[model samples]
Target: MPVTDVTTDPENLTMTIVADFAAPVERVWSAYSDPRQLERFWGPPGWPATFTAWDHTVGGRAYYSLTGPRGERSSGSWEFLSIDAPHSFEVLDSFVDDEGKPLEGFAPMRMKLSFTPTAEGTRMIGESHFDSVEALNQVVAMGVIEGTKMAMAQLDAVLQDLREFAQGKGTQVELLDDTHVRITRLVEGPRELVWRAYNEEELMRQWMLGPEGWEMTECVIATEPGQQHRTSWAPVGDTPGEPFGFEGEVLLVDAPRRAVTTERMQGTDGPETLNDLNLYEEDGATLITVLIEYPDKETRDMILATGMAEGMEASYTRLEHEVLAPAERS
Candidate 1:
């Protein structure tokens, strides 16, 4: 319903769609920047999308699968070519296989999306450039225009759901699937500061401790892929609790934005989990999202039963009051 116009230029091998929304540019932009919000409306009505991987920085790639009502799936990948926050981003979009390899004989398209302020709200322009007329005609024949219109129509509900996506909601958890759990917290700080608080030993020692009466004893931060990072915590003074620690190998790092790591108990051979941390800033507050993939449903249930969400909330509170507050003051 937000779509105002849709056009296809066969001579130029391009298709453009224009939509207007009654939401601020930032609000509209966040819906696309965050994978959680994106998946809610990325696919058409009957085809819900699941983003298996999302790396939003330039040169990064995102892989997603759209599952049809009949259990069929269509996979796709986007290679980010350019990104200018709250303004524009370009990506090489492709039809991909399950493993994210582009399908043979299907040429990829270059799509650029832009967001701009309007008197009423925000206007979004999405333009796709195909390699040849055949390619452009091919996609149009496959219901691309109608599918896109249906997908964008769903964005209206997401933008209006301020309570669910707004800041200061504390740490919240969502069970994405049998093995994937997503935890999100909106912190009162900039993205850079939050990213630093997670990577710097001094800053982490100040707030990474969960609950009161505990102190961090060991902190080894990882700065690059494949590096090992470890942290340990012990109860201080008369506080009653045994010492514990976590160790992880960083699988990917895009500073100030995203990091992916493998985490497990320090000395235990227990199953490990994949943690994908993403940070996005809007209106001076940063949204911290961590998507955790457990080895199985049993492991997921066991971990959540350990008061992990409550503990994370405590840590995030400390992070704001102790780490970011001081940094902001300075």
Candidate 2:
């Protein structure tokens, strides 16, 4: 479990969850496509799930039941509304009785799941919509959030097994020179979506936060030569209140393909860096190539020591799951 973030919007009657995994988009999607894989993590910790009549196509139906620690059983069914292989799927989820009949008085909800590939791994974003705030609150009050977290954690174990079954993985970071570094990764989404995730302020806000509990409070990106590209981040929630800012100048802008810029960290006396992003697409997948050039070797080494690379990897993972994934599905 790299990270999982859950947010509920009572006003919109929706609950959205974002999760990242150290696996490819295809692997993640396979978990749902295959009944055995889905059963392994469909329920939270301490609740083992069993599936019956499983299907992974549009208009198909799946039936499953989870046995609780105390021998309690809860059954459910999903009516697949739509399916897009390796990208997204929509379904109507509902509670059911032991005989596979819908439980009376319980509301059925719509859920959409999207998968995107990032430099580090794949991201899964699940959006569940209810008919009313009361319905939404009812489910949350039943421990859906905590249960979801546990279930997602279990998914990581499943991914580990899958990884062992077929070894390998992730972003390639190379020190091209003392003052230059190049990072490359195969991103599993459309080229246009990848470009927008890199350039759009709203999209950047989703994944560009430097670290956990850090939020991008301000961003103004002008993706044209000689334009301003400034962004700022601040601590959020229980996070420490240290803030950081970056001021950059765009040197080149190429829609859905490449972009070049130069950045300087605010309050730092170190040398500025030149950043270049190149996107290549084939069969709906994009390859992201990033090259960064620092003014001096010492400056680059010092920045790396701050664990900036790890933060960057996390951000890129979030970008894939929250922004790029949803965009590609849409």
Candidate 3:
């Protein structure tokens, strides 16, 4: 697995993967075209299915879940484009974020998955286009490509091992996956005000934690890709207590507009974990997207299971009631 090319700009990121398989084009087609079959072989092995619904027609949707080895699970939907039987197909894919909202920035992938019959078997080629090169890059930076490929490799293995049920040898898929708590809420506020809530320490502290008992003790900010911005919280009972902290570099920042990139260093064992936050204004309101990309399945599931949505909702709720409220008055 040579590292896929990683290129970035202020607006987008792109990733490409080329691989071949020994299965016939038809078999390969089934693995990608049919939602039922597609779900079986997708994602890292040991990933279980929670629910999968497929409508294999253009304008139809395919929804499925894949639980990773460490119980980390993800669910996403696909909108079919042209379903060329046994040869090619196109679909859109996106997951329900921690907020349980389909962040437009992260969904609707236009993928051209084609299979060419070869003397040995089939040469599979897939190309997914974004609304623009920037979107492609944004997702690539979000770590979707690596995750998608990991899941696809598992799919490849599953298809190869498929046996004839008539021969008493059939591949059985075990659907056991982890689940996450996702919460969604819409905020109506100016982009600048909302940006202040995130970039300004005074405002960030207001909504970043509970009452003073759990106030943010440490706040640091640096405006660069490798910079760090963090805040800490301490419980009520501890005396001279150290606050729980979050440490992450400033991957990319377009202050007053959006900040996209990674986080996680305080409690992790390796490099910083991944996170991104975006801000877009529409019709006098600012729409923001915040993403937390875990380094591995273990962390992914743990972070999800830790009530990320609830925690975030609490903060956003505060932002609305505290910060945005004041902005509205003025």
* C-alpha-based local distance difference test score of model 1: 0.87
Per-residue lDDT over 1-330 for candidate 1, one digit per residue giving the tens place of the 0 to 100 score:
888999999999999999999999999999989988898679865466789999999999999998653346899999999999999999999999998899998999999999999999999999999999999999999998989887897687578743346566788887756987868888878899999999989888888888889989999999898799999999999998899999988887767877778899999987899887867676677878787889999999999998889989999999999988888899
Please tell me which predicted candidate would have the highest TM-score against the true structure. Answer: 1
Residues 184-242, model 2: lDDT tens digits: 66666788888888877777778888668888877998877889788888988789767
What are the C-alpha RMSDs, in order, of all predicted structures? 10.0, 20.9, 16.9
* lDDT per model vs. reference: 0.87, 0.78, 0.59
lDDT of 3 by residue, 258-277 (tens): 46445665777554454445
Models sorted by TM-score, best on top: 1, 2, 3
Q: For each candidate, what TM-score against the reference?
A: 0.60, 0.49, 0.44
